[model samples]
Target: SSRYGEDLGKQDALGNLIRELARTDGIEWVRVMYTYPTHISDSFLDAIAAEPKAVNYLDMPLQHASQNVLKLMKRGGNRKSLERLIERVRERVPGIAVRTTFITGFPGETEEDFQELMSFIKNVEFDRVGVFTYSDEEGTPAYELPNKVPHRTAARRRTALMKEQSRISKRRNRKRIGEVVRVLFEGESKESELLWQGRMETQAPDIDGCVLINDVPEELLPAEGDFVNVEITEAHEYDLIGRIVLV
Candidate 1:
């Protein structure tokens, strides 16, 4: 579940609601997205670690990693703090997939700042990442900032960041091969009707990668929303190929 613009972990009421939903027997997976870095509390991490139904994944958007750029954006955390938080999260929840987003070419962002962000990505090695170019939104604090980055430069930076992430994603996905994972069947694969599409616990619906199920027995085929175990056989840049493992 995503709480856009608001940090769910900071709000006790919403966090409790999510915890309750995660503990529900019928809910196969509970994913959290768009959590602010500074506001992620210990209670939130504890609940995620303890809940069996809570998917071990998080989407935390850290706009930029460079201290100068982060300060300009008023994002309330430095590179060191973010690194520490990520480490803590991983330590608290083993095998958790951490997804994050970054912005490129923000106002006053120097070449060194961009490189610093790239270095941060390499160091963090996030399980999933997305990078976007800064847009000049009128009436926003950023719009009035000096030294706005050129559109061309911003676009180029976005491409570079995504390229780096593609490599990271492929390497990460490849490690999943040979593992048996529970997949939540979504529907038929978009590429072919003969194949089915599903997502593992690490993969959030729509935003993350999927498992393409092949060679399923007619009688054992799973319905939509059914959780079935699949043995991963192949891994692509963003998706995995697997066949249903009939018990």
Candidate 2:
């Protein structure tokens, strides 16, 4: 099924699909990605929350928060609506790791619009964020628009937004310290072969951060792809340090 499954007259296809997938045997995890904000219904959130196999992680791309910018981008929702949507998502699926992306420097975007976006990032404090600089593509509706944002300005805004998200990410990860969580062991870390790596349910494979295994009991060596419980000993901006508690 599509990431954000379609809604028939009376059926929520995506939510039903997730629930059905969760019921299947030998399927330990069902992770979804890139769900559009507008299409995330309560049923969808419920499917994720109620199904033990469905990972509580959402990757929604909210292109821009400013009302004007969003309108120009042909995405309808404004900051207030987006905020309400987030509130609903969090309320429905507690502790769900919400990941999102934003676009900066869209055509006709003003300084005020960019500031509004910056404030949105600070207020939302998403678990993971990605920002892109708007670039003109030939034959697109945006290409012929007036008052274009210079490439340099777009790049600068992307960097500033990322920095703010980094601060928020660090604080969020710090809260995970001392928490015992299930991790999918994935063998040696690229940083060092001496260390091992794994991903928490909240961490989406390679795109998100990882749990760096600093200590493992001699007898409980988990082969790659094994699910193990790890006790978080330390937290960095994007990674957690942990030792195997159960294998």
Candidate 3:
């Protein structure tokens, strides 16, 4: 579920293989992660949108929106291209949850650049966002740079970005309330006597949050391959509290 690299060329073959597997008789869900912005083709996006078994979620790592930092990192795409790519994906697949990561505190990073990245995040309104303080690796150009930001400053930047994202996350999750969402049962809850744990369409295993199934009827509790319809009763910062709608 973790995609460490930024090259889509390395992932396209595997993506095709996964698509073929989705064509198999019983496969019902296929989720993809770690998409590179520059390498994602129109065909791939179309296929992803059209495939029923493929969940419309992509975890693309853009690192930073600042052109200078991106150039130093040797990343392929620019801000304009990133904007276009995002717009394309959303236009192709309505309601797709776009998840992303942004790196902070790169060498020579200006306050204006960080602010620009913040503005970009706000505009994109990503479903899930993660920010990492830049780690200087030996033999990397960034490591050899003279204008290294203080560790505290980097941490502060990371915190600030995530704080903004937290509000966005809460607002997005709130939109699901009162809507019927299909949930895949993961297990029974230990904390609450009548609560069972499950995940809705937007949630991935362990990374994103989950839905709590409370006060379920005897014949309507969740099981594997059984997608239970549940109405979102409450929305948390990262998860949902819901009761089975039994549709």
Candidate 4:
């Protein structure tokens, strides 16, 4: 929820929770999701970096990058500030996969605002990115706001942003090639039974990309829900190809 850490004097409650959960017997991975940018403290990053059980991943959705549009939407933050935050995050937690989402064509979102958003995406090479077109809701302030953007324009902006992000996403995935990583086996792939699938630590069970297992040793096979080390041999825009590296 957006109100994470709002209670408990706004302390690093999430960080504390991660540490506590890590001590549990059967919990192998502690992954956090939907953390708001405003409350990501250094202590939180420290917990993630220090705890081996804590996955090196952060899911913070920055709804928009344009200060003007953000203010209009009541979610305030400019590109410069966000860039600094991301820089700090990376410095605090090495090898972290940062994931974010954005909205396009918000009310009063001028072409300049969209361009600023585009520039932000290019400047910050996030590990994963998602985009959405703005839609109005009843009884909401945005629905009654002036200078509402047209549907076609909002959709166009969403497409353009996603297209640019696709290149960045592919580049991000390509970096993982040749890395030996542990993956949680999930049995046969949806695309084909001969191909198996699993998720790396950076990829959430459903919200992110997965590692597709195309080869396996005849004598050794990983059962569903088992942890196995895979040697990543190939990377795609949204998936990875790897062979089981463990016997």
Candidate 5:
């Protein structure tokens, strides 16, 4: 419903709702997700930037970078437009964590198209990324499109894209070390009862990485949903290790 145009009274309405929720005293963070790239408005961006409680994060799915592939997918906006939009967002809201998804092996996608996407990814260096291989759905227009990518080729492309993103993610995470960040405690870490888990402002609840709380003073252990300042001690591929900063 949030994806619908303003004529449907849902697009800006969703942004209004998010703004209202951010004003609530009990709401520690507001994270917006699944914002379609073409429909993202200035008002929506302003709301995100102005609200102190709104996390500086956005989940905008680009799907693909190739102009030809995007035209086929009916998702308007080319690589240059996307770059400009992203730059504008960062300028409006500094330290924003932009997460995006891309699809590989779309119909008529060539090796040149795939390489263009890889270059785009390198240039953007998004905070988080998800990749998928094209899948045919019976009722979708793409299913009937010509020059469908081979299944095996699609799988290979997916793997290659993920590998590229892994390196970017690791490098981005490494930059967080030694910084004190506010983490919203989630629960005990799945791998160890002695360790707790939380997410920083840049991390969305479930889809993004986490900060592992280790060696915290007994009295300072935060309960689930509590926000605590953690001094990052280590950084891994997709996670961070930190100790509670007793303020």
Candidate 6:
């Protein structure tokens, strides 16, 4: 919540919890969400990248890149600072999957601001991204602002942003083909047990796609909280198919 955002010191608690959970027996995956850009630090990135059990992924939502819109939303950071944080993550972690969220149609969001956001997205080349049209909550200052973007306009902008992200995601996923990725075996797919499900380091537990193994060894098929190596052979829309390399 915004309350925690007030103090950057509280940010370490979430990352610490992830480390604690990953050390647990039944905890095979530790995914972090709703991270704000301002709270990120050098230590947090180091811990996430070095942790063996934790998935090497971080989701920091920087709603808009424009300075005016950021101030209006009280996001607590500017565009330059956001870019530096993204660059820092890439520099510190070799294969880190940086996911982020965005918002469109905030009151007074201009065409220039939207273009700036698009440029930022293109430059970052994030592994995963999500976009949403602005929702005017009861207590938010945005709700009471004039020049509220129309629903259709907001939707069109959101679509444009998503289209950009979709292409980038497809390219990133395709690059993983033939790589031996460590997957946390979750369970059987709805289609059949022959089709087992799992996820690579870049993927979170539920939000991201899964690794679909067509056939599995009787002993290697995991119940849960299990880690195995899978060689990515194919990519689906949001999922992948892999052959077991280690169990």
lDDT of 4: 0.89
Candidate 3: tens digits of C-alpha lDDT, residues 104-147: 89888889888888888888889988899988899877788878
Q: Which stretches of candidate 1 lie over 4 Å from their true place?
A: 1-15
Off by over 4 Å in 5: 1-5, 8-15
RMSD of each: 2.6, 1.6, 3.2, 1.4, 1.8, 3.0
For 81-184, candidate 5 gives per-residue lDDT tens digits of 99998998888889999999999989999988899899999998998999988889999888899998998998898899889899998998888888999988
Name the TM-score of candidate 3: 0.89
lDDT per residue (tens digit) for residues 1-247 in model 1? 4343255444555457668998787787777878878767776777788888888988888998888999999877778888999999999889999998899889999999998888889888999888888999999999999999998998998898888888888998899899989999988998799889998888887788889988687678678989898999999888999998876
User: Which scores greater on TM-score, model 3 or model 6?
Assistant: 3
List the candidate numbers ranked by lDDT, top first: 2, 4, 5, 1, 3, 6
Residue clash pairs of candidate 4: none
Please list the C-alpha lDDT of all candidates, in the order they appear: 0.85, 0.90, 0.80, 0.89, 0.86, 0.78
- Give TM per candidate: 0.92, 0.96, 0.89, 0.96, 0.94, 0.86
Q: How far out, in Å, is residue 90 in model 5?
A: 0.8
Q: How would you encode candidate 4's per-residue C-alpha lDDT over 144-183 as one tens digit per residue? A: 9989889999999999988898888888888889988999
Pull out the clashing pairs in model 6. none
Q: Which pairs, if any, clash in model 5?
A: none
